[model samples]
Target: MKPSIPYLLAYAFTLASRRADEELREHGLTVRQFGLLMQLRLEPELTMAELARQLGISRQSLHEMVGELEQAGHLRREPGATGRTLRLTLVPGTARLLFDAHGPLMRAEEDFLRGMGKREIETLRVLLQRVLAHATDDEAWLA
Candidate 1:
C-alpha cells in the first residue's frame, strides 16, 4: 500500500532536515542556527519576541539559542531602538558562513527534488507557499 500524503510529507521533511543538518554541521552550524541567522539577515534588528513569534518557538528557547549564537560570535543582541526588547544582529563574519553553507543547502534541496520537472517544482513551491500563508496569518513568513 502507498503511504498517505501526510506521512510522505513527514518522511520527506525528516530526511531533508537530517541531510541539511549534516551539511550545515560540516561548517560548524546547525539548521536551527542557520535559520536564525537567515531570519536576522532578512530583517535586521528583529526583537526577541518578534523573532520567537516568527520562528514559532518559545521566547525562553529562542533566548537560549541566542545565547549560544552570541557565544559563538555569530550574532549579538542589543537594546531595541524603540523599546526594551533586545534586537538580534548578526556578526560581521556570519555572512561568510552563510555563503559557505548556501551551496550545500541548495544542492541538498535540489537533489531532494531531483526528478521533478521545472513546472512541477514551481507548482510545488506555490503549494507550499499557500499552505504556509494559510497556516500563519503573519506576512513575515512569506518574506
Candidate 2:
C-alpha cells in the first residue's frame, strides 16, 4: 500500500538527512550547527540575540553552540550594538569544508527528486510550502 504524502515526505527527508548528517559528522557539525554557521556566514554581523531568534532556539542553546564553534575556530565573537556579538569566522579551511560538502548535499537532493519529474517536484514543493505556511500561523492546521 502507498503511504500518505506526509509519511512519504517524512521518510524521504529522514533518509536524506541521515546521509547529510554522515557528511557533516565528518566535519564535526550537526545539521543545526551547519545552519547556524551558514546564517552567520551570510550575515556576519548578527548579534547572538538575533541569531537565537532567527534559528528559533533559546539563547542558552545558541550560546552553547557558539561556544563550541568558537573553541573549534569556526566562529568568533565581535563587537555588536552592545559589547559583543556572535559571527561566524570565515576561515579558508571552513570555506573549503563548505564547498566539499555542497556536492554530496545536492546529490542527495537530486537523488530524492529522481523518480518525480520536474513539474511534479515543483508542484509538491509549492504544496508543501503552502502547508507549512498555514501550519505556522494556525494551531488548527497543526491539529
Candidate 3:
C-alpha cells in the first residue's frame, strides 16, 4: 500500500526542514527564526497573534522566539494600533543576514527537488496552494 498523502507531506516537510535548517545554521539562524523573519519582512504590519497563527506556533512559543530574536538584534517590537497588540519588525541587521541566507536556502530547495522538471514543480506548487486555500478557507493563500 502506498503511504498516505499527509504522511508523505509530513516526511517531505521534515526532510526539507532539516536541509533548510542546515543551510540557515551557516548564517546563525534556525528554520523557525528564519521563517519568522521572512514573515515579518513580507508583512511588516503583522500583529503578534496574527504572526503566531501564520507561523503555526503558539503565542507563548512565538513570544519566546520573538524575545530571542529581539535580544539578538534581529527583531523589533513596536506599538500597534491597538494598545493590546504589538507589531513585529525585522531590524536592519537582519536584512544582510536574510539576504546572505537566501542563496543557500534556495540551493537547498533545488537540491531537494532534484530531478523534478519545471512543470512538475509548478504543478506541485499550485496543488499545495489549493490545499492551503481549502484548509485555511482563504482564497489569498497564494499571496
**TM-score winner:** 3
Q: Check candidate 3 and list the clashing pairs.
A: none
Query: What is the C-alpha lDDT profile of model 3 across 95-129, one tens digit per residue?
Result: 88998999989988898899999999889989998
How many clashes would you count in candidate 3?
A: 0
**What is the Cα-based lDDT of residue 22 in candidate 2?**
71
Cα lDDT, all candidates: 0.82, 0.72, 0.87
Backbone collision tally, model 1? 0
Instruction: Highest lDDT: give the candidate number.
Output: 3
Query: What is the Å distance of residue 143 in model 2 from its true position?
Result: 31
- C-alpha root-mean-square deviation, each candidate: 2.5, 5.8, 1.8
Task: Put down candidate 2 lDDT per residue, 1-143, tens digits, no spaces.
Answer: 88898898779768867767776677787667777888777677767777787666899999999888778887776665555543445565766766676776666567757888889987877776677556455232233
| Tens-place lDDT digits, model 1, residues 19-84 | 888878887777778888998998886678878877778988898989999999999878888766
Q: Residue 118: error of model 3 in Å?
A: 2.1
What is the TM-score of candidate 1? 0.83
TM-score of 3: 0.87
Residue 19 of model 1: what lDDT?
A: 83
